[model samples]
Structures are given as structure tokens and as C-alpha cells.
Target chain A: MTSTAAHSPFPSGRAVPTPVTGGRGGLLASVVGVAVGSVFFLFPIYWMLVTSVKPPSEWLTSPPVFIPDRLYFQNYTDALFNWGGLKGLVDSGVVAVSATAIGMVLGTFAAYSLARFRIGGTNLSFFILSLLFMPPVAIGIPMFLFWSALGLVDTYIALIVQYLTFTIPFIAWVMKGFFEDLPVDLEESALVNGASRLRAFVDIVLPNVRPALVATALLAFIFNWNEFSIAVLLSRGRVTTLPFILPTMMESHYVLWGDIAAMAAVGALPVVIIAFLLQRYLVRGLSFGAIRSE
Target chain B: MMATRRRPSRWSGGRRFALLTVAPATIILIVLSVFPLLYSLRLSFTDQQLLSLVPPRFVGLANYAQLLQDNLFWSSLGVAAAFALSVVTVQLGVGLALALALYRLPRYQQFIATLLLIPSILSSSVASFQWRSLFDYSSGPLNYFLGLLHLPLLSWTADPRLALPSLLLVDFWQWTPFVTLLLLAGLHALPASVFEAARVDGSSSWQILRYQTLPLLRRVIAITVILRLIGAFKVFDIIYVLTAGGPGSATESLAFYNYVQGFRYFSVGYSAAMSYVSVIIVIVLARVILRYMERPVGRPAADVPVAEAAV
Candidate 1:
């Protein structure tokens, strides 16, 4: 019912036709506006890079340098290996991989079933997507005790399972939408040709939706990779994820921005790159099914 | 397929497999996701502490009563509301503006879009700690930058008044793109004909935006607002890392308050009750958003004018 509104913003980026009397002024204003906007948008990332490269001397200097004199590569090198680097990396990697694996292998089938099968109602998709709307703190404490009772606290399994509360519902809901947008005739033809349903799904339908599946897995991986609170709640120092570890570095008086920046930059690199590369699907993967209003 | 199968008394392979395969994940969700939730519901009524094995004595209305009378509870609610409203509104405004600006910039749109998506991908804690140096009072970049403009030095975390807004600024910086992305999608999905028709008929940009784009985007805006609001309401990780609801609860969102009450103070029942209250607010907010999106905006009534129809 809502689609009939008539005016559009003319796609707000339209180059305003300059007036002759104020011609240069209008052009100059827009140019300045663009530069200001670019700075505002980019400054934080720029700061992140700057801090990572700054020598310990310039890390917290007065009038922080927009550019550093010497490239401080050691900051990154130190942050990683300082806190039992390989071990921290392994722990974080284990938790993230485990969570993403669980999300993918199990979430894929449920998502496929939800998309293809008419389960309970036409609006089941909305119901599923709405699960992503839940705040994690909603269940964090309860799950903490639950996992503790299972003697799973501070273990990899506890954190991995907790990640499911987020990744499963999100992956399922998003992949279901991606799957629905796929033409069903390819799978139907396979069914008609006497291949079993599972085979057809694996060989035919899956290959087609592989981009989205990869995207979902990667997104799920990133979510787990970056998650801190649950890892903190369940795993104090025992199973520290990268995010959990980074914050503890600030507790000391000589807060090393050189190392923190290096770690932050390095840590953010993989997911940030993935997010950029697969955003064609990952952005869609985020609330594509979620925005269905029913 | 069910109809086509002979001996239909037996379940078809697809149906059987789907059921069998789906059940494990469903069961896990029930056990891990739903059961703990239900468990928490039960615990909210009890006098149970973490270590206690003795069955929780049913405390009935006491937990709820305590939460009602709790000063911290009220303050927390206020904090949460302020954070949610301020942060979400700023982000929404900034995001909408950015999206509009970038929408017509065909050449730079892709680069800007990628940059915009960074916060969504970066863990908030990572963003928080990285930003900690930026907000440092004495020698930080923020003050240094302000020093350049000869502006008064601002204490971001140290000053009680500024702490909340400081955190909000962080949230706005990080999440505006999310709002932009959602609104951008809505912008993309809009039909071109309506805007073109208005343009052809000599409508000005301001009138067209007011009369046209706003109405068409109402549902998307509502959904984005709701999602972002709920998210802001639950703002925890970043704030926890940077401020920890610092300078005397200035940045204490409801979720953080609940965390403190339960974990720090060991007031489990009171915290549980607080959680229940917050959950109700979130559910209502979400439902309102959901309901708002579904309501008829442009479905023409007999009396409404074309220009004002979306309103």
C-alpha cells in the first residue's frame, strides 16, 4: 500500500546547476562540502592507520600528527607475539572457526528447508528474521549459568555455542531469502530426473547459491571473530578471543597505542577486507530478509 | 510432490529428510536459545543465586516490586532512553544525509559505500579501544584537532556531562552507515516513474523530497529506526570497553545496568526483573515499528490529496 508516494530526492547527488551570478561560489561551496564530508567520513580509519604507524614517541603526542615520521612496524609485530601471540591467535581462531562452522553446516539446511518448504504460514520468514532483532544480553546471563552448570565455562565449546544464538538465526534467515530468490526449476528438474533431494540440493542448487553461502559463512565468521561480550562472559582469561584480549592491554598505565593500534589494525584487516569484498552479498546478507514487515 | 507420490500413507523422502535434518538445529535452538530464556523467566521469580543448588524459593512479586522502587532502575531506564534516542536519532539523520549525498554520486558511490560499511564489520570493542586514544583529554587527537580551531579543550570521558554524548558520538560515527545502507536499499527499490513524473511536471527538489521521497521511504525508515533503536538500547560492548558507564552512570544503558546489577552486585533477581522490564519496552518498540511499516501510507482514500497522501 505504501509505494505510491510521488516525489523522490532526485537521487540527492545531482550536481546542482550553477547560477551565472554566483557561478564560482556555488561550485566552490560544493567542492568544499565534498572535501569536508570526505574528511568526516574517513578520519577515524585514517587515525587508525596513523596510530598503527606512529612511533611510541608520537603515539600520544600534542597535536597528533596526521602523518607519522617513521613507519613503526614493530608495534604490530609486538602486539601479536607479546601476549602469547600464536596461542591467542589460535584461541580466537578456534572459537571463530567453530562458531562459523556450526552456523554454516547446520544453518544451511534449516535455511534451505525454510525457503523451499511451506512450513506453518506465509509469514514464517518474518518470524525467523525477527530472531536477529534480539539483543544478546537478553540471554547472556542465563546462558552463562547454563554453560557453567554444564561445566563448559571458560571452554571453547561454551563460547562457540553461545555464538549460535546470533549466527544461526541470522544465517538461516538471510540464506533463506537468498535461496528463495533462486529459481526452483533447476532443483525441480533434478527431482523429476530421479536424483534424491539431498543430492540435487548439494550438486545443483548449492553451487548456484554458493556466492551467498560463502558470504553467509564469511559474515558469520566475522561476527564470531569480532564478538567480545559473550566470550568475555563465558571465557574470562581462559579462552580469550582477539577482541577480549585487546581491551586488557589498556589496563596498564603506559598504554601502548603502538601495539594496540597495530593489533587493532591487524585484527580488523581480515574481516574488513572480507566485508568489503563480499558486501555485494554480506550487506544483503545482513538485513535482506530482516526488513520484511509482516 | 506429496500428491504425486504413490502409497502416500508413507511419508515422502523430501518431507522425511527435511524433518529429520531440521530437527537437530531446531532442538539445539530450543535447548540453548529458548530453554535458557524460559529458565531465566523462572529464575526472575525466585530467590536463587548462582551457586545455590537448593531449589529457588518462589519470591513471587518481590523482585518486580524491588525493581519498581529501585532508584538505580529508574536512572538506568532514563539513561537507556537518552542513549537510544540521542544515538539513534543522530545516526539516522547523518546516515540519511550521507546516503542522499552519495546516491547521485555515481562515480564515488562504490568507494563511499565500502568505507561506510566498515563500522558494521569492525567489532565495536575494537572500534572502542581504538577510539579511546582519540578521546583522551590531554594529548588526544580530538583535543589537538580542537586546539587547531582554538576551541575550548573538551574532556570526553572525564567530564560527566560530555561522557554520554561522547559515547553517542562514537555510536553515531560507527552506526550511521548501517542506517544509510538500509535507507539506500529503500532508495534503490523506489520506482523511478513517480519521481520522474514529478520532475517532468516541474516540481522543485524540496517539494519533491517532502511530498514524495519521504512518503515512499516511510516503511523503510520505520524499520531502520526500530532496528537501530533497539540496537542502541542494547548498546553494551563499545560503551563497556571505553566508558564502562563511566563518570557516574552517564553512559549506563539498561543492558549495562543489568550487567552491573547481576554480575557486579550479585543482585540476580533484581537484575532479572530489570531485564524483563527492558525486554517489554524493546518488544513494544519493535512491534510498533513492525506495525508502523505495515500500515497503509499511500493507499488512497477518497478524500486525501495526491501530494499529501503519504502523510
Candidate 2:
């Protein structure tokens, strides 16, 4: 087979092979490997979806039902309304959205400064990056104590504040990388043409980085949405997120497997959709632009 | 007229603007992160308990002393280390193999890779819940399938021997895609010219991979390993949901232990000490990895950017 693909980094590195034709056996092995890997990767998700729609009887049946006898849409409603999953979902949405919005706004400014002005030098950027490596639990513990002292536990503000520590650094780093790659001449030219720095940034540079901004926001949202440890510790009753609620639901009497499955499915659906839709930007965002596909 | 006059001093004006723009984030990080870090450092030295009536008392080194002596503390550290080591190894191995396989088939690579990326994007708690149900002893499809094959059923979460490994399996299933994508990116970034040279010299695929591809991919592999290692060290959500360090604390990681002590037991001071110890280990590991990453392999050190090197 030919091995000349373009060098675009989108959808991952371009597929350039070694021009060696795989024999029939090699071809068969490749197909089998891909198939098995795909199944292993997808089965749990498939099971979650199927189990969410299954009746309780089929849920526990031997030779577990691959497809439900009847599609039970009630499981979702029961999960959302009766099981308090609605509150969890709303809480997660609020925290994630607020955290992402705050992180992006603050991060964009810091990133721009670092990118354009070299504010605080390179050491400052590295310092921010190092914070990303610190385990959230380490930070979460003292924050828990501090928030309790301030009577801020179980409040959205408490969670959002802590989430900023993580999201801000992330947004700053990713946005810095994006800003570095953009040509400064446009902004500089605008500045020379009587526009203020702020005006030049908003009018010229911001439009250029809009895609990166969206990608970073989505990624930050995902991180907050998936966050469990800090949320679990900081929020007890009033601001319980979906992830925090799942374990509690499991701990309660008469474990409702169907409802729990429905909750998990519903909770994961938006992220899955966002991931699929924004797969390209997702790659760049996750890597902090270290592996951008040009 | 005043605004236009001030424009000539734009250099200094820009500097002030930049600092103003950066201050909110820097200040927020300091208050939220740096302050908590300092507070936790202080709390680690005190005799503090959330459930206690008395205020915290200064008890320097007492918490650390007790932590060092506690068998559960030591055991949890071991468990965290083992979990991190095993998960990183397994994920890297499986992920690299899959990446290699996927790299060959250019036709179906994107479609399959996107499907593989699904598990990685899902929240750990949600993934844990899904896996928890899948591993359910009585009703899980895993056991059902085992029964169909006339194999003995396994209690995945309840069995002490299996609980940690079960958590590992869930993590492995979820994160291997991340490693795969990183390595696949590395593989794609390989210089095709080198591969062409090897092929022209009549090198077999295996020979090319071992002598050529593997050596070139070392930096990426190191990166993937370090990232996964750091993540695995902080694993809490999956274990928290799957077993809560259950079946006799068999699955308790260091982070989970900290969670239980601080939140469940209200032993604030002790948990703070544990957090400090964990943070030290992570920072030390990151430093060591960064040092190793800086060592020049075929290329000059200057060729790798500082940001990428640090990453």
C-alpha cells in the first residue's frame, strides 16, 4: 500500500505507513485486533445504555439480556425525578458551567499577557503548569477545612472557587500556547493604527482564537463535570453533583440498578456528544497544545 | 486629547495593562491554591479533628509521627504505588500495542480511534458506576457469560484479592485510549524518511520497529508514562465508588485513605499529613521524570521546546 498521507495533525497524526503490503494473514490479524479492541472499549458503554432501558427482572436475569424485552423509558424519568438525579445533574451543570466560564475569562487574560507581554516571565508559566500536576485531593483537604471554617461547605461558591484553581491554570496554559502560535503582527498593526491594546485584543486577536476558546471551555467543563473527590468533600447536601450522587445512590437500601444505570447514562451523554462533536479541538485542548495538528 | 497624549507612553501603559490582566488569575490561584497549601501545611502539624469540641492545638510532628507509625498508612502507600505501577504498565503496554495496530490500517483508523476515545471522555464516577454494574455478582453480564460457559462466578468488588485489580481494570479500560492517542500521535509524527531508509535497506517490520521506531518514540513513551503515572497516583473516584476501600480496605489508595480519614473519620490533621506526603511524592516523581525527559537522545536538547520538555 502507498504511504503518502498529508502531514495534518487533525484527527491525530496523519497516517503514514511504511509502504509494506500486509500479507493476507497480516491483514486478517489487523482486522481481528481492531475488532477485539473496539469491542473491549465499547462494551461497558453499550451495557450501560442497554441496562438503563432494561426492566428490573431482565436486569438480574441469567445469561443477562442483551436487549431489553421492552424499552423501559420510565427508568430515565424515575432516575431524573424520583431518585434525586435531577438535582445532581443541575448541580453538576451549574458548577461546571460557572467554573468553565470563570476559568476561561480569567485564563484568557492571563494567557494573553503571558503570550504577548511575557508577563511574569517563563517561570510564572511553569509555576502555573506545576500546579496542574498537584493532586486535587492534596489541595482539596485544606480547602475543605478552610471552607468549613468560613461556613462555605456544600455551597456552589465553595466548589466553584476550588475548581478555579485547576481550571484557571489549565485555561491559561492552553490559551498561552494558542496565542503563541498566532501571528502578533496583526495585533501590533492594529495597535499602531490607533487602537488601544484592549481594543486590538478584542477586535483582532480574540476573533482568531475563538475556536481555541470554545475548545478550552468545553474541556474545562468536562473536567469540572467529571470531578468527584473535591465535590464530594466540599459539598454534602445542597450542591451534590451527579458523580457525588451516584455513590450515595449505590449505598442506599435496595440498590436500584436500573435507575443508577439511567443516571450514569444520562450523566455521561452530554460529555460523549461534546467529545464526538469537538473531537478535533478536544485533542488539542487535552494536550495543552503540545501536540496540536497544525 | 488626554487619552491621545497618553498613547505615546503605550509601552509602560501596556505593561501595566498586562499585569492588570494577569493579576486576577494569579491572585485567585494564590488564594485558592497557594493559601490552601500553606494552610494544609500548618494543619498537618496541629492536633485537629473536625469532630472534636476543642480548638486545634499546636502539636508539631505528632501527626507525621503517627502517620509514619500507622500500618494502614504504610499499607495504603504501598497500595497506591502498586496501583500506579500496575495501571501505568498495563495501560501503556495495551495502548501502545493498539496504537501500533491502528497505525497500520489507515482506512479505519479515525473511526475506530474515535470509538476507542469514548471511555476516556466519560467521567470516572460514571465509568465506575457502569463497571460496577458490569461486575455485579448476581446480575452482571460478566457472571452471566461465565455461567453460560460453565465457569465459576467471581465477586469482583467484594473479593479482597480482586477489588484492587477490579479498580485497575476499570481504570485501564477508561484510560488506555488516552495513552493510545498519545502514542499514535507520536507514531504519526515520526519522520517517514527514516522509515523509508530502513525499508530500502531491507529491514523487516519487526526489525524496523525495534531498532528504528521504538528508539524514536522514546520521548513520547516517557511523556505518556509520566502523565499516566501521575494520574494513577491520584485515583480516588473509581475506588471511591466501586468499593469505598471495601472488602477490608483492599482497594484503598492513598488518596482514598486521605478522603476517608478527613471526611469520614474527621481526622483532619492526620489526613492533612497524608496529603502532604502524597504531594511530595508526586512533585519528586515529576522532577525525576522531567530530568530524564531532558536527556538528549538522537536530537539536540535545543530542538525540544521548554514547554514540551516540561510537559
Candidate 3:
């Protein structure tokens, strides 16, 4: 159902094409409907922004401050410095980046084998995709026991290793889809000309799917960065990711609404930017390649 | 034997390359995913406690037997089911409406869709916090708006009855856009010629949608539904932040209860049993969906020309 007429015969990384024409009266209603729906969807984000900048006095006003007349940078500074947001974000960054680097390299190769050679065929593909569906707690329990036994809990290595359970499979499955979409003519011809298998793949195949590689990596990074369940089980206080820190803030003597919002905004900003940048592949990535971008 | 031998010899180097490249990821998955699953499965049958000094002893079927009769288990399953069903249903309904609406405005579809990605793109923890302020009893914008309309102020996540619904609201806000995006893509893929033919035959817009558009959209809808179902079942982040399964366990999902058993109470054996159950349920659900999704998209009815059929 993802077909687009104008798609080039040779697969190049691009988004699904726009739809054909619409009926006459439906256009006006669509405008109004989408506009209203946008407000409903966007209001909470606006509220978060408003709360983040509201002064302490305006934080809990009965008539909620829709617009915080006076902007405050104190909340941002306090959350970043006094609270654990900065440290937590840094921890999250290290874990996500390192894990993604390893996962992409490993996954790209596995994906190549799966797509090109059809290794283990459907069963192997199913096994990998199923990992995405497995609830984290199932693995989290056993992982906790294993890591604790190794005395590796709360270390960056422990978190990075655990993250591979998700990232590797995710990248492998998504990238496999992209690889399959690519024609093998170029690689075969390169190999026939006496280029080594690895060379043919690295020199020809990799460049064609560059856009997909980046999109898959970013999506995998987001999953790692947003992880909460495994982090909650594995980390005590030593290795706090941004998501893990928010709950602790809520548990404090008094809930710091402004500070929490500030921290959340800080954590969410990067992914929001990436989400737009990779908008073409967003649906494909989120759906784990089930819905192709034509 | 001869065919297999010939196949390998034909691409001997390629075969070796495939094995070498695939080995690392396959090994990692085995260690991290397969090994842990097997360990957890073993743990489920044994009386193990992380905090205990006593060596673990196997107690086959005890934990599973207890789970069958456990009231808390039953209640939490009920909660999980209710939350999953309602959220999936509502999201699909609202999502279809919005997608159809957006389909009519091709000029602004991409722009609007991009903007709609914001909520889903945010981490669940951050999204939950955003909602936390919105559902606050005293200072929440929702209640404030209620007050302006002369309605009594209502506690959202604090009240026992309202708590789950409140969490549902947040899930709805965050995920409906995703459903819309998928369905809109499906809508776009429908052939324009089919719609034009139906229109020429004097069929109304609703008739064309009912007869032509929907049948072609079944595959996309199925994929979307299963994906959402799997996601709804695994919902933990928002529930953790928003309600913490509070107000006398009104919002305590099976996942949360499992977490409490495994992590907080350290009933390793019992928690592992629950985890196995959850995994089995998800595996079964996903298996069917995956097979359906993986099936080749053959010639859909829309591809058949309309003029020839009328003759």
C-alpha cells in the first residue's frame, strides 16, 4: 500500500510520495479539522514550555498561567546544575552513542548477510524482529541477575551491553529492509570485476543506503536514550539516565514542577530536532520497516 | 547433497563472507537475548530470591500454580487488558478520522504530519511529565478550564476511578498521531483512478470510500492495529510517571506488578513466571501479525481497471 508512481526504479533513499487530488468541499473542512486537531495535540507541549519558564509564584496559580508574562531562566539553570539533569543527560549520551556505534556496525553486517545471502531465511528474520516485541522486564530480570553476578551493574559497560539487546536487532531488521529494497546488480558487477566481497559492499552497497543507515542509527539512538524500564532495574544511583532521574525528582520531599519540566525539555529537544530531520523515514523506522517509504 | 555442494562451491567466498559478517550480531543476540530468556525460564521454576542467603531450590510448577490463583495477578491482568483495549480502540477511531481529514488537504499534509510527530517523538518520561503538570489537581490547565465553565474541579490521576482514564488520555495524545500517519500513508497509496471511476459512475464519496478505499486499506490497518496492540501491552513509562499504579492499584498494570515482584520485593521466581506469561502472550500476538505483514503485497483489487469490469 506504500506505492508511489514517481518513485525511481533504482532505489534511492527518499520519503513516500504525496497523494493525488482531493475533492472540493473537503478541503475547507480539512483545514479546520487539522487546525483544531493541531491545537489539541500541541497544547500540552505549550503548557510544558510555559511551566518551564514560569516564576515560582506563577507555577501553581489557580487560573493557570497560559503565558508566563515574565520569563525565567532560573529553572533551566537549576535543573541543569543543581539537579541531576546535566549529569544524567551526559550519562545517557555516552551510553546511547557508544551502543549505537557498536550496534550499527554489527547490525549493518548482519543485515547485509540477511538481505543478500538470505541466511537462515524467515526464521532468522523472525527471531530478530521478535526481540523488538519482547517486553524488557522478561530480559531485565535475568539481565539484572547476570550483571550483578559479574559485578558490572551501574557501569557504562553494563548499560551498553544491555542496550545491544534492543539496538542490534532494531538496526539489523530496519537496515535489512533497506538493503533488500536495493538492487544487487551493482554489487554483483563489482564482485565480477574482481573486487573483494567486503570491498564491493563497503564501496558500492554502503554508499547507496547511506540515508537509511543514518536514519536507522538515529532511531536506534532515540530508543536507547529513552529507555526507562531496564535502566530502572539495573541502575541504583550510580548511572542515572535522563529518564531514570525524573522519577527521583518526583519522589523528593516536594515535587519541583518547574525544574522537572525544565529537565524534560532539555532531554526532549535533541530528539525532536532529529525526528524532523529524519521525517521521511520516521514512519518506516517507528513501524520497524513494516510500512515502507516508497 | 550434490545440489547443496554445488551451491556453496558456486559462491564459496560469498558464503564465507556472509558467515563472518553475520556471526557477531548472531552471537550477541544469543548471549544477551536467548541466554537471558533461558535463564529467566529456569528461574521461573525455582524458588530464588536475590536477597536471600539460602541456595535456590527448584520448585517446579509452584509459581505458575500460584499465579493461576493469585487475585493480584488477575486484577492486574484485567487492568492491563482494559487499558490496552480502550486505548487501541480510541486511538484507531480518532486516528482514522484525522487521517481521512488530512488526506483531503494534500497541500498541507506533510507540514501538519511533521508537526504532529512532536508528541510521539518525545521520550515517554518527558511526555508523562508534560502531562503531569496538565493533570495536577490544583494548578492543572484541565481543571482550570473546567472551573471557567462552571463545572466542579476534578482530580485526574488522584481519584481511583479517574486514574486509569487519565493515563489513557496521555497514551491517546501521544500515540494517535502515529496511527494517523500510518493510515494516511495507506490512504495515499490507494489508486486515484479507482476513486475517479467510482465518481464517474455517480457514486458518492462515502460509497467510494466504503467500497474501494477500505478493502485496499486492510493490510495497512492490520499492521497498525497489531503494532499498537503490542505497544499498548508493553506500556510502562507513562504509567510509572503519571500514576505509579496508585489510588489503591487502580492503574497498576501487569507490567508494573511484575516489576514490583522482580525488583522491589525481589520475588525472583514468581516474577520470572509472570514475565514468561507476558512473553508468551506477546510472542503469540506478534507471530500472527508478523506473518501477515511479511506476506507479499500481491495485485490489490484497486490495480484492476474499472472500465473492463463494468462491461
True interface contacts reproduced by each model, as a fraction?
Answer: 0.28, 0.47, 0.52
lDDT of 1 by residue, A1-294 (tens): 122211232423333321011134433554454456567656887888888888888877776777877787887778878854456678878989998998888888887776665342334434444455666666767887888778889999888887887788778766776676676678778878988888988999899988778878888888888888787778778888888888888888998887887778877888888877875564456553444211
Residue pairs that clash (backbone atoms under 3 angstroms), model 2: A9-A293
TM-score of chain B of each: 0.84, 0.88, 0.90
Supply the TM-score for candidate 3. Answer: 0.92
Residues B199-264 of candidate 3: C-alpha lDDT, one tens digit per residue: 668776677667777676777777888889888889888888888888888988888889878888
* Per-residue accuracy of model 2 over A1-97 as CA lDDT, tens digit each: 0123323333222233352223456556666877899999999989999989988777677667888778998889989998788888899999999
What TM-score does the predicted chain A of each candidate obtain versus native chain A? 0.84, 0.91, 0.92
Candidate 1 clash pair list:
A7-B212, A7-B213
Per-model TM-score, in order, reads: 0.87, 0.91, 0.92
The lDDT per prediction is: 0.70, 0.79, 0.82
Q: What lDDT does model 1 reach?
A: 0.70
TM-score of chain A of 2: 0.91
Model 3, A22-103: lDDT tens digits are 4556556666878888999999998888788988888878878888788998999989898888899899999999999999
Model 1, residue B44: what's the lDDT?
A: 89
Q: Order the candidates by lDDT, highest first.
A: 3, 2, 1
Q: What proportion of true contacts does candidate 1 retain?
A: 0.28
What's the ranking of the predictions by TM-score, best on top? 3, 2, 1
